[model samples]
Structure formats: C-alpha cells, structure tokens
Target: MSISVPQLHAELPTGCSVDRSGFMRRVSGVQAVSPISPPRSPVPLRLSVPGRLLAGGIGLGCLVILMIAGLVVPDSRGVGTHEQLGMPACGFLSRTGIPCGTCGMTTSFSLLVRGDLPAAFRAQPFGAVAGVAAGMTVWAAGYIAITGRPVHRLFRRCSATWLVGILLGAWLISWGWKIFVVVGGLVGG
Candidate 1:
C-alpha cells in the first residue's frame, strides 16, 4: 500500500521544510491540531491471542468492579456513597451548595443495577447510559476472552474528538436536568 502526498516546488515558501521521508512538509506559518494522534500498534501485524485476552481481561475486570460496587451499595436520594465508604463529602458540593457533574453517578449506577430505571434517570441519565455500556463491555470482553479475538479495530478507527464531544454533551445534558429538578423542587416546596 502506498500513500500519496502532494508535492511542492524546490524553492518552497519561506518557512516550509521537507521531512526525512520527503513526503510531509511542515510550514511554520500553518498551525496543526494534533489532539488525538492515533496510537501505533505495538503488537505485530498478526494479532496475538495473549494480547487479545489481556486486553479483554482488563476490560472485564473493570466492569466487574463497577458491578460489584453497584450491588453492594444501596441507591439513596443524594450522592456520596463514597462517604459511606469513609471518604469525605464532595468539596465542590459543600462549598457551592450545588451538586457537581458526577455527584449522583454512583447512586444512578446503583439504581440502574437494581432495575430502577426512573430513579436512575432522575439521578443521572449519563449513569444509566454508562451502566448499559458497562454491561455490554462485560459481554463483549467475555466473548473476546473466550474466543481469543479482539474487536477493538473499529473503536480505534473512531475519532477521539468525536468521542470526547459525545461524552461531554451527555454530561452537560445530565447536569442541566439535575439543576432543573433541584430548582423545581425548591420552588414547589
């Protein structure tokens, strides 16, 4: 396979210089955005079974931890199940008198695991979405672990900016809903 790069004249613009490969030339005047450079595969061209299993195992382990936390903790009206585990309250919430973006995520996950969809949505819509994703990841990772194959190439092809945008959008939307509910409740009561 060959990649074609556009050619420029020998006497290029003032700040343009050719790279070692003589394919890409960088111009000083131009700015490039390199937010998410695609990671070069460390694994050889031929996929290794152990590498696939290792990746799958790591993903499965994270999902298991999340599911266990959900199972053990009881979902409550507010956030800070972490406090129940002897952690401090959310400093942001304490100072601002408002919940932060991740305030109710644990409770939402717990409600989701307990099959309480409405409460999960009320707590944080993103949590329900994340819970669903965690479940799917566990299933997919389990399959890859058993079959010794990976399906990560598709994810690798996706743009990092697009994925980040989707996540931030979800969080913003969930935060807006939480604010609206809190304000509405204050007004009603």
Candidate 2:
C-alpha cells in the first residue's frame, strides 16, 4: 500500500486528528502547539551626570570637614581628646608604651597645622608626608568629579613596592630614634 506524503504528514494516532492542510491540528482534542514570545533584554542601569556630581560633592564635602576637624582640633597635652571622639590611636603600640609606626602622628599633625614644617618632621617625618598624600587624594577625587579628568597620574602609576619600602623605612628610622633616646637617658642617669 502507498501512502501519500501529505496523508502521512497529517496522520495522527487514534484519538488524535489533523487539519486538511496536512498539519497536525490537535492531539486528544487539544491544540498540538502554542506560540511563544521572544525573551526581552534587560534594561541597563545608569546614573545621570547631575546625580554623579551631587554624590561626589557630598563625599568630598564630608572629607573636607574631617580634614578641617583633624587640623583645627587642638589636643597638644598628649592626652588624646580625639580618642573620646572615636578616633583611635594606634592599638599595636599604644598598649605597650612603645612608639608604634604611627606614634608621633598626632604631634606631627599639630605641628603641620601650625605651619611648622621642621617641627612636624621632628615629631614624625612620615606623618606630614601621609597628611599631604591624603589631602592630595581627596583633591584628586574632587578634581575628577568636577572636571572629569585626573589631576595627577603619578599615584595611579606608582608601584606597591615603592609604598611598602617607604613605610618600612619610616618605621625602622622612627624605631631606631626612639631606641637611641632611651639609651641616651639610661647613660646619663
């Protein structure tokens, strides 16, 4: 027996049926297939330039306030008033009565605020450098927000090794100086 191609294409099992156009119409009296819609792409999230500027401005403003407070608030008696204000002195060395890497930072900051560069260095050479570096960082961020351009590229290009070396050298020099002072006092006594 020869079956026509259209008949074969349209043919369905018992309890199923096909339309006259040689396509399966239904199975068990139900539609054979349902059409599906294509999936939609996700919408991208974006911040407007004005919104970015506002956020940047707020952040920079907060930083400026902090810098001003740090410089202006006097705590020269060696008793930390900033500590009560939630500013923690270095924990690693303060507990031991030994000068930590950042021991003279407050004194240095005080000297810097007073415009005494030599006194600042005498207090803690690295602290003045750190203060300037931090100020420059804030300035750069504000500059980028305002002008959409980097103010300085040296920090971006500087290597991690250079930073580590500077920090280590500063710490060792400060530690050595403290030791020398202690030794000199013992010898004099």
Angstrom error of the Cα, residue 88, model 1: value is 1.7
Q: What lDDT score goes with residue 121 in model 1?
A: 81
lDDT of 2 by residue, 1-189 (tens): 222236565335544555565555445555456458877546433345775586477558647644664655544432243464577875754576555666556655655666776655655567666656555556665656666543335567878899799788977886565445333432210
lDDT of every predicted structure (CA atoms): 0.70, 0.56
lDDT of 1 by residue, 1-189 (tens): 223355655655454566656654556567545468889978625337887677687777868757665755743644675665567888887887677888777777777788887777887788778877887788777766766666776598789999999999999998887666555653210
TM-score of each: 0.65, 0.50
* Top-TM-score structure, candidate number: 1
Off by over 4 Å in 2: 1-81, 84-95, 155-157, 178-189
Model 2 lDDT, residue 154, Cα: 51
